[model samples]
Target: MAYHSFLVEPISCHAWNKDRTQIAICPNNH
Candidate 1:
């Protein structure tokens, strides 16, 4: 597993086709 440093206020994914965006987040201590 890899930990990435994301500095954005919130990481968001946008879909142009009206589909839902996908994201993975750590749940326990994230």
Candidate 2:
């Protein structure tokens, strides 16, 4: 899956918006 790296932070879990234009990421706190 080709994605824009600068847009999304390095995360283990994420969900794209309904339109697939934006994303919600769960940042790791470690």
Candidate 3:
């Protein structure tokens, strides 16, 4: 799940975010 953050940032494109349910569970979402 934490691995997904890598894609979340670049792909965000305008302060957007993908489902953070997984990110919230991640140990490195900080």
Ranking by lDDT: 2, 3, 1
Q: For residues 1-30, what per-residue lDDT tens digits would candidate 1 score against the true structure?
A: 222443342444321234423345545325
| Order of candidate numbers by TM-score, starting with the best | 2, 3, 1
Total clashing pairs in model 2: 0
Weakest lDDT window of 10 consecutive positions for candidate 3: 21-30
Clash totals for all models, in order? 0, 0, 0
Q: What is the lDDT of residue 22 in candidate 3?
A: 32
| Model 3, span 1-30: residue lDDT tens | 455555656533323348544323233434
Report the alpha-carbon TM-score of model 2 versus the true structure: 0.45
Candidate 2 per-residue lDDT, tens place, 1-30, comes to: 458673455555667779987767665622
Model 2 scores what on Cα lDDT? Answer: 0.62
All candidates' TM-scores? 0.20, 0.45, 0.22
Off by over 4 Å in 3: 11-30
